[model samples]
Target: MPPEHNAGAEHMLVSMLRPLVERGHDVQVWLSRYGKAHRAYEYRGIQVVPLQARLDFGTAARRADVLLSHLECVPSTAALARGYGKPLVVVCHNTHRPSLRDVAAGQTALAVYNSLWMEREAELFFAEYPKAIRPAESLIVRPPVFAGEYATRPGKAVTLINCNREKGGRVLEQLARRMPDAQFLAVKGAYGEQILPALPNVEIVEHVDGAEMRERVYARTRVLLMPSSYESWGRAGVEALASGIPVVAHPTPGLTESLADGGIFVDRNDIDGYEAVLRRLLGSAAEYRLVSKRAKARSAELDPAAELAAWCDAIEQL
Candidate 1:
């Protein structure tokens, strides 16, 4: 229900809901807090309504048949679903600390995890809670990506999507300094903006909408850098792979599963290792081409239509 920013979770929500609407499902998205000013709008035939208060939600729930809740809205949405005796489906976008309130709320809903690693973490987290507070059912649904949206092209620079400490902004700075000959492009993320003043070789790019990623970021990216401390699924890495650009990232559980053999995995703190792999890719055209081929092949496995169909099947059964 947050404004549809360039974040991966928001992108996934739009991609999934749009197709459902196209299939003749009368789907409406209700924002709990944000985007209240932009009260009503039609996006890809899906109606978005902003709920201002508890009363507004109660009124809306009376008209709705099922409740689909995101992470932040789980507590309130779960309470409403219970009150209305509706089936609640909670979509877990990331690995979050489970509070007693969240655990209690989860009991009344079916959980849909974005990745297998996330599902394992959620199960572990819920295991610490009382049995009565555990979710009724849980399922893993990898986030969908439109491979057609990206293109393979000649690239000249190494790109990092998000410039924040948690996202490996400092790692990018170090790499930029070590490889002065390599061009580094840092795309501004939703959080943190203090990266520009430190690194001279790294070019800072303003954040663009997800639809503009190919022309604005991937087209000029020889390799994608994802040095995040944690990742639920690594959406940017998947996007880069779709463009035939190899991702060099720390092997977080989500990134490891998403990239498979397509990525160049480096330890989170291994600056030397990252530099070695990147230098090899930049210096040898053959190596880059080989990795690009692997990247494309791996990306082909992600079929958006298939994923959407699976979602439809699951929702129908629910």
Candidate 2:
């Protein structure tokens, strides 16, 4: 686990593992590179272990029946699993350049994709490779959000989780200038700095832990904005929906799936269209109420227990 904090992948990992722990299944998280040394504590009954060196990988791998890995750790973990004769489960959290070496190695028993779009993307990326080189099994497991963790409040501002260019900082700047009457809250992210000029209406909030999202961000959010050019799955949109807040985002495949009827999808380049949609929602109480209801309804679709069961079933079969 490279990302120590403020990562959706890490948050989703914790959510999936917590239920397994409650069910009395021994679950442990081993961080390949430790950043938050002082913060290494048991989380929801699972011990967080930090590996000191590459040599420590074998010790940890030997203890686990199935090795689960994500992102940068996949290649090394895949190699280790091959050596240990353990089932390697690779979780695809985002769309990236598929490594031919890793996929062709035949070590991965399963590939767990976060979205159908991501799964399809992976299939396309590996289309040129021989069929035998691909992972034996592939499945879609949408990210889960605990609806009970969020609540509907009397919020009046439009919220954006991350303020980097990749997360649409330029769009935020344009929107802020175009819609001066609208209030926007931009939460800083780990990847990029805020380069947008200061605007009176847009308020920049410091990043908060995943546990504090409801209280710190969603509490004052009327609508969520996800103007990213690309996304495998938009976690912030679902988080907003859990709070009964509608999302206005670019019509990316992942966003379309996650937000569903709860979102008003506008084109990324259509600034005027974005403004028009926002105006309708903000200006009309009835429309906002309807969208809010839909948002909550959409949020209900993401059942953490169901997702955990799916993961458990996959692990059991593995």
Candidate 3:
């Protein structure tokens, strides 16, 4: 029950947790609990209890019946939860697990993947730990974007998210330089500071929550720029499309599937293809309108609340 550190994780947690609380299940969120940033509070009427860091096992065991954690950070939480005989649920997001070298060192942990690709990775990971517990198949849940408040795109700035610099910053910066006419907004903070300030045309804003993020990023956004190296279903792309904004990206793993034909993909380093696609979309009001319309229509099919309610039903059965 760690209060997740990232906005995407937070959104998913809120969506899933809210329903469970309404159904009368007690919920507690543990994190870097002693830190000032980690405050105990209520969210949507659910009481949030933040446990202090380095807390004793006896204290943690008294609190909950289950331990739900992210896949990558599973080892410590799983071990602790297992010691207390609590049911552990690992929400897997990545398609790859730690290398064989890490496994041989006795790191046996549970994982529940977001997609089949990640589930396959978990199988490979558990090959090294015969006793490793895997999260129930019923626990596998899709990452969700907040819906209902989608806005019509104003066909202005090319919205680029500088999530990970090693992943997409250089290309976005270069594109901003080339397409000087196109205004670029970097969903900025932490990692973004490295490149966002250097580009004069790029405006940087602190991270946004689900609903606000959808409205703000989609409101004035012309095209969504996602040049990611990898993703477990790029949430931003889903949000943009849900808001009737088109995305242009490189065909990275999860993103390729998530964006589908709702996006235009450039061949790796195919700057010309990228430029041409952008120009084509920007050139015609009619073409832009059609793409935006199709993007939202595609996103509507993956309804967050419906999917979340289904997930909650499965979890309650556990």
Q: Please give the CA lDDT of all the candidate structures.
A: 0.79, 0.80, 0.65
TM-score of each: 0.90, 0.91, 0.83
**Candidate 1 residue-wise lDDT, 216-317, digit = tens:** 899989999998898889988988888889899998999999999899899969999999999999999999999999999989886667767877776766
Itemize residue pairs with steric clashes in candidate 3. none
lDDT of 2 by residue, 1-318 (tens): 323467778877777777778777888777876465545557667787765523465787887898888878888888889888999988888776754345546787888788878877777777755564778887777877887887658389987888888787888888889899999898887567764548899888886777788888999998888988988788888888887898999998999988888888998888898888888989999999999999888888776676678788888788
Error of 3 at 17 (Å): 2.0
Candidate 3 lDDT, 1-318, residue by residue in tens: 322334455556666777788888887665533443445676665565555533554576547666666534456666766577776665656665452222222323333445555555656766866765444443456676655655554548887765457457667777788888878887753233446646778887656545466566678788888777777667778878877788888787677777777877776477777778888888888998899888877787667776667766666655
Candidates sorted by lDDT, descending order?
Answer: 2, 1, 3
Candidates 1 and 2 compared by TM-score, better number: 2
Q: Is candidate 1 or candidate 3 better by lDDT?
A: 1
User: In model 3, what is the error at residue 190, expressed in angstroms?
Assistant: 5.3
Deviation of model 3 at 153, angstroms: 4.0
Model 3, poorest ten-residue lDDT window?
Answer: 99-108
Q: Please name the candidate that would achieve the greatest lDDT relative to the true structure.
A: 2
